[model samples]
Target: MSELDDPVGSSLHGPHAALARRVGRTATYPADVATFCAVPADPAPQDWADLARLVGPGGLADLFTAPGTPPPDWTPEFAMPGRQLVAPVPTGDVDPRVVELGRDDDPAMLQLATATRPGPFFARTARLGTFLGVRDGGELLAMAGQRLHPGGWVEISAVCTAERARGQGLAAVLVAAQVARTAADGGRAFLHVVDTNAGARALYARLGFTQRRPVLFRGFRVPG
Candidate 1:
């Protein structure tokens, strides 16, 4: 058949899906979108069968792979096109003020992330990877951190700055800091952004991130 015939082991196309299946807190939706959900990245045929059996009927999930690539027999609710950007080793040190956030900071992080609409930030998202943020006068101003870490690459995600703190380059610092940290660990840094977000794309460009490839995010609802 074609290269897309069986998308197993195809997570090289989407890091989020890969990371999700690897380290994400996975759960099935008991009450549809009203409850929690999980994703399987680059699922092999067996992986799809396993997840399908696990979730059963009355469940839903979301995952991403290369555009037009869904595992055999899985259906997609929607597909969102996006751009993937990769940054090289940072040239400077992370600012001293950027602090690592812990579980205690989830409340503030969730608020900031929700207000900024950077991406998904759930209650226990802190367990995903290292999250760093900047605080100004006791207020969370900006933040960014690791996401998918498959192989030698760590995906930088949740880069956001409070509205009151915009135009100050706080987002840049957080992104650069994440990139620097990833490099220090002997790994590369990358991220995914909606292709239509011109402002974010510009900022990432200025931070020395180049467009690596076009990606697609596919969300699916298992027959529930």
Candidate 2:
């Protein structure tokens, strides 16, 4: 299978290896970094067994885009239809207002993501890759950053602007900055958007991203 088809697995096995925790053939990011788990594309019983043990009883098995259904006892948490889009790096200068965020910016980053509900951002999610933000004075107004690194591609995620800051094109600026950064590292950029978010889909299209495939973002609770 293409690495993109099993991005979580490919990331754990490739670029994000050091950040992974493995239990037999299953792997997952740390709880504070991300909740994503990776199982074999065509999961066998043992693969499910490994995932159960890795997350422990009652823990969430956030199977981000992997198709295998868990055992009958696993309770569904959520299932969202999303599309993966890919784009060539755009040639442009990053907005002068954009700044690279560092460890000190974690609290603000987490707060903004929580308020914006952009995606599954966590306390240490910034460790996944470079994060950039736009701040107005001391207040953070918008942000975007990289997440999964599957072979030659980087997943741009958590692209969001504050409620009061929308319509200023901050989301577009932040996304473009993220794409530029990925290009600097010799990787192309891609992102996942909920299929129902027509506005986001249109924005990405304007930035030159085209749908690569539909994906499902799923999470389930491990049976106790």
lDDT score of model 1?
0.67
**lDDT tens readout by residue for model 1, 44-154:** 555555555656654444555322333545566766788877897699778888899987888898889889988666666555579999998778999997765556677
Clashing pairs in 1: 58-224
RMSD of each: 5.9, 1.1
TM-scores for every predicted model: 0.76, 0.97
lDDT (C-alpha, whole model) for all candidates: 0.67, 0.91
TM for candidate 2 is 0.97
lDDT of 1 at 84: 75
TM-score, structure 1 vs. true: 0.76
Off by over 4 Å in 2: none
Q: Candidate 2 — which pairs collide?
A: none
- How well does candidate 2 score on lDDT at residue 106? 93
